[model samples]
Target: MTSQDRKDGIPAGGAGGEGARVPVTDGLRFAFGTLTVLPVRVTRWDRAAARAGMLCAPAAGLVVGLASAALGGLLLLAGATPLLAAVATVAVPAVLTRGLHLDGLADTADGLGSGRPAEEALRIMKRSDIGPFGVITLLLTLLAQVAAVSGLYGESWARGAVAVAVAAVAARLALTLTCRTGVPPARPDGLGAAVAGTVPVRSAVLAAVLVTALCAAAGGLFGISGSVRHTLAVLAALGAAQLLLRHCVRRFGGVTGDVFGALAETAATVALVVLSLG
Candidate 1:
């Protein structure tokens, strides 16, 4: 290991470094530091830390979700219209992540819509300027998210809050799955390469199960039907994300940070849509 790696508490030889166990706190820092605009400082950069951070991603999502829900709920309690509450709910995640995922979604849309070779498409994605495809995708995605959240809020404040939280957690769960072993990075460097295939498949699966169960429990605040609805929402969201991941992998030769962002936004949107349905 380099002196820098040692200073960062990373094990030698990258992820294969045996006998190195990262503390939960370091993992949490990694997750929050990279995934959101939170003030946490990440002290590690090795694959071991990445694996642990991905495993803890859902927990970070939970915190973001709760913060989003809180703002929306407070607005409702203050007699704000459901539309406004829904807008706040949709905006909170974007604000927290510094719009990183939305930007990714746009870039990925541009890349996919270019109809060019993988190399050219990736080049398109790297451009700072948003293309027509990216603009349209962003417009449609934000509209759908706001509309779905509004519909849920119309039903009841509690339902809206629960749905928001569940969607956030589901979004991060998708990220965890995307990093599972066998998934390759599209590029030789960048955030995607650092985290790609770092997580064990079994660990990813366990994280998904736990996140889904917790979502179900949150929905159980209403009734058995509520629990079932939330459970299905999580499953459906993950399925949608998985399809996107597969398509991106084929089109780009593997995943990138932009692809990860696209996957997250897709999952969150799908989860909210599913929850809004009867």
Candidate 2:
């Protein structure tokens, strides 16, 4: 839809047959998209309006993160194997974010994984097919996550699930931060654009901090004690993720959906590893 139409409160999903079809504002679209994907309606898309859609980014991240955990749980329960579990998580998202992370992975791969100049690598990323760099990046990240979870599950399955859940939450929280916190646009459109359309940085910062607090508490499960220490670890993880993301964004000239995915995945993996070691 046109930006003007979006501004005019044209519903992304237009009028319905049965009842009053309140025009879905671009403001609320991501939140609506998020809620619609969940198993429960505990939080409705309409609720996001109060927060000016900043919550939507984190909320959407939460859903995907949780979905990853649940999917991971099912895989572990069924003895489905770690690699298989990873595959399931990717496959399960019916509305698959149009290869959101895959695109980032590809672009980043083109830029970093490939030995070519940055401009040429980025051009290669824009291609639909995968390159050797893209393939390797995807494989390595997937393997890293699967291996990390498998190792955690070996130690404590509950902790592993918690790791997955918290990571999911954290990753999503990352999105809110990126969208709201003065993230310059990388592309004119795509995930970054939509995020720009929604969350404001101030609200994102608060929400991200709150999420970090919760995650730090989750960190305690790794044998780290005291809420204060745990919170510090969580903040540390987030701080590290921020520094890492900043570098990646600067390197790429902007973060894409894949970088968003990669950042979340990397942070989650790091958190779980640190917890396990703790």
Best by TM-score: 1
Tens-place lDDT digits, model 2, residues 21-73: 33335335544343234332222223234234446545565566567668767
Predicted structure 2, TM vs. truth = 0.69
Off by over 4 Å in 2: 1-54, 74-99, 114-121, 219-237
What lDDT tens digits, residue by residue, belong to model 1 across residues 87-178? Answer: 99889999988888898899999999999999999999988899999999999999999999999989998898899999999999999999
Candidate 2, pairs of clashing residues: 61-172, 65-168, 180-200, 180-201
Task: For model 1, name the residue pairs that clash.
Answer: none
Model 1 segments beyond 4 Å from truth? 1-19
TM-score of each candidate structure, all chains considered together: 0.93, 0.69
